[model samples]
Target chain A: MKYIIIASLSSLILQSYLTTILKIDTIFYPLFLIVNLIVLYKYFNKDNLKFIIYALTMGFISETISSNTIFLQPILFLLISFIVIYISNRIEVGNINLFLIVPFIITIYRILSYFILNNIVHISITNQLLYQSIYSSIVINILYAYTLNYIFKFISNKYKFSMYD
Target chain B: MKKIKVNPRYLILSILIIIVVILSFISYAIKSGRQLSPVESLIKDTVLTTQKILMAPVNFVSNSFKEYQEKQDVYKKYKELQKKESLFDLQEAKLKEQQTQIEKLNELLTLEKTLSDYTYQHAQTLNRNLNYWNNEISIDKGTSNGIEVDMAVITNQGLIGKVVSVSTFTSRVRLLTSSDIHNKVSVKIKTDKEDIYGILSSYDKENNVLIIEGISSNKIIEKDSVVVTTGMGSIFPSGVLVGKVESYELDNFGLAYIVKVTPTVDYDDITHVTVLKRLK
Candidate 1:
């Protein structure tokens, strides 16, 4: 719980200030996707009530600060996060499997947001929506091979808790 | 078939989902263009205030670095500026003359309002989460600064966007590039022969251009012709630069010309903006 709070708060700060400080264009990075996947990974096979509550919290923060729309962010995060966790649990989430799972979650979320924000509400998002999803997922998936892989290795070694291949 | 198992929890969940769906529509309808409730204001003000303070040190460091970079080419830049100074003086004088002439014409025509009549407040950009793409930016000035919804946001270069929502101390400016169907700017393209009018309908993010559609005329729009707001809808003040024409094409239905415009302001690196408030 503490780690999730720290991670999300830090990510929020990063999302707010990182571009200005570093002078980087945000078109290339999938900030939301990276954070969503991190939370989803942590929630997998955990306490269901806690997971659902966290999903709601994620939705609230997004809506209050960034999205400024009601229900949509929360609803999408709840549904998608639930499915991602359920699938990962059933599939025995592996580093190899993550390449498939992460992209699927991202694409679905983008498509749904396109329908809601663009079609239903007219808060239009353009083709760059899909473009960002594709490229960001690819970049993240590659980075996961090093960072997530190392973290899992470290955890299994120190805690005697193994991650299935 | 054996009795299909039914989860009582699923029944309760389905009811809750239906209730939430209905509530969403009700809340959304109530929230549009409405004053922020105290809770909403508190949340937004706190978050935006924190972001503003945090950004201060970051901006100071960034500006210092920029100043250092600028100092390196001071001699070369000084020579360039010296040569440009006389031309700029000439242009400034010409602009002032034109401004007075326009003001006299407005009086002669008995017009109530003109573009130059608006007052502007400088605002610093803060708490902008780029994850949503080029949709919106939060500015430091808000209702307290007399900023309101639909006010025009501009930089020194040109028009950037209009304010969509405002809180007590912070407001969000929806960029011209937003895919929102209602995000249209009435623009004018003046050429040698005539003033071509069109609506800037949408932004092409991939190419970094704005598409001005519904131009019924076939008169060739020259490349790099300046586009500016006509203020026909009164949402934006007239004569604010939108962009320059890059390319044009015939629509699929063979009805109108669709001209592509390259926006003058760089949306990527926007730090400060001026929000224009029309004077009564």
Candidate 2:
């Protein structure tokens, strides 16, 4: 529950500030995807179907409000979420390795979707946009993931909210 | 008898994947080259209203800081204008005579006072987002506020974009900077001799320039000439300033001119805008 709140709030703040205040071109790299992916990986369970749904809903709404394609982002987010959980379960990897791998996965998924689904041609897959996305997702979102993870871990330890159950 | 055991996690994941696929199909059906249905309108309105309420404080803080910085510059400009005020007063009568003569000529040409006389509604931007192909910015005014599709969106600087979709409380505008191939506008170039006409087509996003095509190479289009809407289509009124020509060159076949334009409106500073509701 605490993780869900933190994830959603961070998504909102990033949406509000990144494009308008920071003035960074986020057309290629969606920062919220990384946030949602981290949440799913941290708290994937049989009992947490509600969390999955909530995260997916937030991701959809953010993309709809921010981008042209309403349906595409949510579907991609869910697919990525499923893949991440499956991969992490199959292989025991450390947090740092997972963090490093997330950006490459996202960039490749975006490039494939841009070509196959969106039918956009004549655009290079490995352009500056790919580099920017890799930089943003790894450098910026890794810090975000750690900060939120630390805060949640602290709260769960102190409050005894029975949040996991 | 033996019972097969299954993990609930896999079951839930499969269900979620199915749901995502179903929702995507429905969304694609709803958006299949038609106007938004009532359900889509309701959803968009709710989201936009929530976003507007949430962004109020942020916008206030940002605008306050910007206004403070602009205050000093405003004062300096005011002092400078005051110095020139007396000299400009002498030219006012002569300018008025010239204006009346121009209006008379415009009346004869059936091109009634261009963009200056349109009824407009002021609206604040809610948010802006971009995708791989296009950029969309939402505004507070909507159908309830008399905003309709295809209305020209402009700021004090110049043309910003046109409203593409409208709900009850908010409207989504497609920015002129969008790189969509179909996002073209008929424009006229204001040269010293005569106005040359062309189509303002695709945007060069990397260089922040607009490409104006279909111009005949024989036409003497001067560099730095102002470009404005031709009002060929009822979507936008005539003479609304768009941009200035930066450079011009011949096409591959050397038959027509491809001119580059520097748009007047700064996309980064778009906060408040007005929707032009044509009088006619």
Candidate 3:
């Protein structure tokens, strides 16, 4: 519960900073997803499917708050969340590797989704705007995700967890 | 008589799956134009309110810092003026001459009288991101106020940028000097006879210069000419100051002059700006 609060607060701060300071139009889903994933990983049993659902929910909430896209973002997040959790479970590596992999996958997913929506559906994100957005997500999302991971770890250690279990 | 066993874990998992599916269906239904549950609207409103509250302190601190810096600069300039007071008479005459020249330039361009119909709401700059691709800043105003996307934003000196996105109480603006490839601006050069058309291209930060293309070769292009918006599109008015030409060179094919410009607005010191509401 404490980690969730911290993660949400940090997400708000980063969101404001990105919009106000960077002046770039961007979404902070990767940061939100990574934080929630860390919380689920530490508290819930690795084998439980609840972890997957929670990650998906976090992704959905994050993207919805950031932009105008409605149902598409949540559905896309569910699929990506499942893939990230599955891969992380299969690998016995340290937490850092999982952190790195999640954002990279999310970034790729966002770009591919953008292409499908704008090109196939004829939604029309100009080539220049699309490239700028992808570049921002790649650079900014990685740093924000890592920071959130560490902050979540700190919060988890400070408070006992019942929500995850 | 075979013994049958049921796994408790399997039962719990099945129930969880059912709940998730039901929730998903409800979410989809709401997204597809079904009326939002009262609870959903409440949640959305709460989140937006919290975001606005969170931004307030950040805006306060940033604005204070800017004020402090401005005060320091004024103090420094004051001290320098005191030291140079012995030559004040001579400097005053030169300053008056420069002021006259500025007035003459304004007259030559037939600059409109400053509009007084709109009252400005001051906003504090929360951040400045000046990377090669994304040049932008965020301010502490949004749709809840009178700010709308695509509104022209400018400082006292010249054009700053245009509003891009508006949250409930915060907005994002894309700066004119952003190096992002998408930042194309249509501009016009004020010549002795008539205004000439051009497009703003590359931005050189090191030298604080902007490159403009599309000027015709036959036009009598000269260094130090003023460039302003042509009002070709609905984006800006016809004569908002853009920059002055710093230098020009003939292109390789001699089709157009490669004109460099120095923007009139001091982007770094901008703290407050006005958003021009289009005349109805």
Instruction: Show where candidate 2 strays beyond 4 Å.
Output: A2-6, A13-17, A26-30, A46-52, A67-70, A90-102, A116-140, A162-165, B1-34, B102-117, B130-134
- The 10 consecutive residues of candidate 3 chain B with the worst lDDT sum are B29-38
lDDT of 2 by residue, A13-41 (tens): 55544444444454323465445565445
> What TM-score goes with each of the models?
0.81, 0.81, 0.60
Compared with the true structure, all predictions reach lDDT values of 0.71, 0.69, 0.61
lDDT of 3 by residue, B87-198 (tens): 9989899999998997798799896442322345567655443211235565667777888777777777877777766666556566787643445677888878888899
The 10-residue segment with the lowest total lDDT in model 2 chain A? A116-125
Ranking of all candidate structures by their TM-score, best first: 2, 1, 3
Q: List the DockQ of the predictions in order.
A: 0.30, 0.28, 0.15
Clashing pairs in 1: none
Residue B176's lDDT in candidate 3: 82
Query: Comparing to the true complex, what docking class would candidate 2 get?
Result: acceptable
lDDT for B276 (candidate 2): 93
Best by DockQ: 1
Q: Give the alpha carbon lDDT tens digit for every residue of B1-280 in model 2.
A: 9998889999999998976676566345324423455666676677667666777787789889989999969979999999999899789988999999988989899995565467889998766664443256778898999998888999998888888778788787877876545468899999999999999987766677889999999999888999999877777788898999999999999999999999997775677899998777
Return the TM-scores of chain A for each candidate in numbered order. 0.71, 0.72, 0.68
What TM-score should be assigned to candidate 2? 0.81
Top-lDDT candidate index = 1
